[model samples]
Target: MSKQKTQPSMIGRMLRHLAGTHAVARRAFPSATLKAIQAGIGEGEKQHRAQVRMIVETSLSLGAVWRGESSRQRAHELFSRYRIWDTEENCGVLVYVNLADHKVEIVADRGVSRVVTRQQWQDVCRAMTAGYAHGAYHESTLQALEQLHVLLAGAMPRDSGDTAGANELSDKPLIL
Candidate 1:
């Protein structure tokens, strides 16, 4: 009687080595993509370095700078529709309504829960839900766009031979 012993085949050893090497390769990080992602985050931080007050005022002052009453009203209306409602205790709910696009986005600080009453958020959310529920987003956005156009028309400078036009180049009136 003879006892036979079977060792791992040469091909099996080679395949095992190849599998281990491939696993290491997959775990290796791509340095270029990582650098690009880091650079993008740094740029974003640089852009938002300004204080919160500065950002809020800048958004609010657009109306005054445009120098048009209707546009100003529209701006105010838009603000009234949505603003950073109460940031009590370093927390706030920011609301923005892009009526022209029939979209509403809200970002709230969960860290400061109960900062704003749930009722208010619900109301805005309900309106958005209604639009989505009815598939009326497009129609609402169109209406808002029309309103925005009307406001801009009032603000845009006219070429009606007025002092604002290019025809008024003379510093003094010439009696020619």
Candidate 2:
């Protein structure tokens, strides 16, 4: 028989969330790195019709944690809150990193999701997770952006007159 893994205890999860503060996120992604990520997003958008947004959060609130909010749920919330779904082509992608949970989530809008399978999105998340595990925050983020650029370019190439669509969303990386 196959065995299933158990989740961490509630107390353990709470402790981890408490320990992961804004300082922890700042340490992982300094100001320079954040700027680099923003630049990457801008450059990547030039190659595709999709909009990409990244959010790196230190941890969820105690209330959220107590409510058993998973990283994917938090990512979806951020996606809606940030209006990533309001892109012109409806091809916005959100990359969410929850440090305390050690989880990476990719939430793509319907237009992109129709072309990119869930497994493909998970693959991107896995690659980023591997790099994060090794403490390569900047490198991992840029790499994931490159991967998304490739996917978006293939799925929805930017037309010659689509320059206006480039800045549909902000390229800034939100650090929460």
Candidate 3:
């Protein structure tokens, strides 16, 4: 057998791997969807003293891909980069989505993690992934936000007479 070049296949794979860029993320989560999610987060925080941020990235960086950095690793990096783990209450949670890999991860701070197990967060991510796979992008994300609200609300109830806690973090959805 003779060796053959497979540049086309390699290129195709690379292109697909970089499919989810900021533009793609915006399409998957338009302004309307982002607002809905943000509203949900704002409301969700009212019942609890936890901070939550949702970051959706279209694809992994070329460097990260070259290094075979899994979506989980990227998620953790984003979680820290956004300062989700630096909340005063230590109840920060990050719901990250990587469109290219169809990977979803929920990184919760110690305050929340103390009550919510790793499996619980994984389950939520799985549900979101399933939703994305089904092409129910907006619906799935909103639904996930609702579920997270319930969990956070129960685990970290707000202080007495506190209608809403400080907006420790922006209620905006991040796209990268």
| Highest-scoring model, lDDT | 2
Q: Write model 2 residue lDDT over 57-175, tens digit each, in one string.
A: 99999999999999999999999999999987888899999999999999999999889988888888998999999999989988988998898889888898867565878899998
Q: In angstroms, how far off is 8's CA in candidate 3?
A: 12
lDDT, candidate 3, 1-176, per-residue tens? 12244555445546767665677777788889889998988888888888999888888767777676778899899888988888887888889888887789888888898888787777778778888998888998888788888877787888898885688888888888
Ranking by lDDT: 2, 3, 1
Alpha carbon lDDT of each predicted model: 0.31, 0.90, 0.82
TM-score: model 3 vs. ground truth: 0.89
Query: TM-score of every model?
Result: 0.21, 0.92, 0.89
Top candidate on TM-score is 2
Clashing pairs in 3: 20-58
> Quick one: RMSD of model 2?
2.7
Weakest ten-residue segment in model 1 by summed lDDT: 49-58
